[model samples]
Target: MTDATIKTAAMLAIGDELLSGRTKDKNIGHLAEVLTMAGIDLKQVRIVGDEEEAIVEALDALRERYDYVFTSGGIGPTHDDITADAVSKAFGVPCLHDPDAMGLLSEMYQRRDMEFTDARQRMARMPQGSRHIANPVSTAPGFVIGNVYVMAGVPQVFQAMLDTVVATLPAGTRILSRSLPCPFGEGDIGTLLGAVQKAHPETSIGSYPHFDGKRFSTELVVRGRDARALDAAAHDVAAMIEALTMEREGAKSKDLGTGELA
Candidate 1:
């Protein structure tokens, strides 16, 4: 793809457990990393409760706003799993049990000698005309409707579904990144870093600070789809760090010469 070709996506994290902190949501980070590597920029993330109204609202908004909208959670057999119904409502379609999905779940259950009860069969329900995204971890598949992908909330299952979905998506220009360790803190290079960022409009520069009991440091990270711009921004960031280091050394030397504390 061309350097200018960029795909943007949003994530909708569904479930009341996530909001209540009862079940820690572990799928967002993996999705973000996978999307980035696949050349899709994740621009927005929304976490909503298991309520159908909330899920439908989020799906509608995100699907219209981004090239792709991936939803995690609320796709299980439980009564609270309303993602399929919400997705059907969002697209003005009926949520029905797909025969293919039912067959797959049926075979899986039969092979394992487990009863494919009505509750388990709920996993086969999806929006009308949606395509299934095979879940390698769990036999119950996620589905894609319009621009939205409804996947399971379980970390392993979500990751597996993401692999299937990403493989089918058209890849754009992959964003590249570099990280530089800075001995100085933000106070030492804040203004200089800002100037560098302004100079490189195509690249994004960020400074994250860390402390280790006795000293504080910063890590300057540069990211961009254009390799040249990313490199240029990283170079400027390194120069800023070097300049600050030199100034600190020079000040310390001056203090030593004058017999004063630095």
Candidate 2:
């Protein structure tokens, strides 16, 4: 088994529409799930407006802080789509039209019998010395510079680009997660939950509350990369819940409480 180490990642979602609520940001959730499965911890996520300075500052900061940085959006064929330029400026590199990207764009234009104007040609511009990320859906390719991997804003396009990039990345020890649904409200299990977290520092515990009208229920999840650690934590948590239920039963028997044991 490979030595377990936390690999941190940062995400930058660049677009003005997201901030204005014109577009609901769905990319971050998908990216977070994907990164988690690959054992990469998503440390920070930022949604910045379509401003060059703001984007550059965020890019520089995240790239320095995290092991890997991913930016989505602002790679479209529009004047406001200036992610490529901002990225280049952040790294102090010149943005130039990539020959391979140009060739791909030319082929796409020829196939569609469309004229490739300067505006359309702008899609080919990538940071110098950056490798092109294959775009399976659209002609405009994403690029990788150092630890930063730039991807498209469109969901379908971004997903396809991720498939290409993720394969080549180093895989850390994957996290394992297990959830148990209990017929107890969060308020009923609050103290026991805190004790579980305190006991297992390696495992992350989450409580999701649900109401079924007649009763309240919660799904508790324990997550960690180490199987033994996760199992031990889960056992202790279950035991604590059982003990709480027994105490509640005994109290109700004495007319001190009326709620039934979970």
lDDT of 1: 0.91
TM-score of 2: 0.90
- Cα RMSD of all models vs. native, in order, equals 2.4, 3.2
lDDT of 2 at 122: 89
Write candidate 2's Cα lDDT for 1-262 as tens digits.
2233777899999999999999998889999999989988898999999999999999999999998999999988799999999999998999999999999999999999999889889899989999999998987899999899999999999899998888888897888998877768999999879988999998999999998877788999999988999999999878877887788778778975555556
Given candidate 1, what's the lDDT at residue 123?
Answer: 96
Give the count of colliding residue pairs in each prediction. Answer: 0, 0
Score candidate 2 by lDDT.
0.90
lDDT of model 2 at residue 35? 91
What are the clashing pairs of model 1? Answer: none
C-alpha root-mean-square deviation, candidate 1: 2.4
